[model samples]
Target: MKEVVYNSDLHFEHKQWNSELAFWEDELKTFKNRLSELVTRWTDKEVLAQLEHYQNQFILHGGVIENLQETIEKHETNIAGHSQKGDESMDVALVKKHSEFRYQMEAQRQIYADLKKEFFRFLSKYM
Candidate 1:
């Protein structure tokens, strides 16, 4: 029996990428808001300790977001590189690479979302 393969339409849609990019941008804004709240509310020693912990977590979250952004940029570069080549055979490879890149981008986006959720969870402890 041959295994069935599913290709998501998001793999080829510019709107999908734009939508995901917008999602992450909103997530970053939320993180900034939480960070501001933590800073404003840190008055006592216990709160300060919690604030320190959140500060570390925020740095780690920022790093993951940066890595995901870099992966997206790399995929864009790879697609651009392949598109510049005019050969039909290269187009086939470009399609394959684009699919793989989309999978990778989606995976990274999920990771970013998970990290954002974790950040919120950590912030909840202080609230």
Candidate 2:
């Protein structure tokens, strides 16, 4: 008969979590650079006009960016409150912190995607 074993010691190790976090961090950095490039390219009048159109459509969506900003701020406040309490379990605290960071990163990613779409749309219009 073959013996089967489960590695219980590997269950809670955070190495994988750390690796994923690092990967997302690098990806976020790349997204930031791409957004900056698009913004920089907006100096062209056609690009600016396209951006304005995009912004108008976005604004019609009830200030989506502002809502995202507010949600991020709320997450930050929750994290800060938890830190100030100083009595929560480390695991719980870490989860909250990680969630807050994830939320911020996701917000950035959304913005980057929107910007990239607008930039490409502008390019297509001019091409």
Candidate 2 lDDT over 1-127, as tens digits, reads 5332212212222334344445544544554454455667668876666656655554443344445445545544554565577733334444555556556656755665686576567657644
Can you write out model 1's per-residue Cα lDDT over 1-127, one digit (the tens) per residue?
A: 5332222232346446756666766766777777778888777887777667656665665666566566656655654564466321234455566568678777876777676677768677766
lDDT of each: 0.62, 0.50
Q: Candidate 2 vs. truth: CA RMSD? A: 10.2
Residue 108, model 1: Cα distance from true site in angstroms? 0.9
32: Cα error in model 1, Å: 0.5
* Global fold similarity of model 1 (TM-score): 0.57
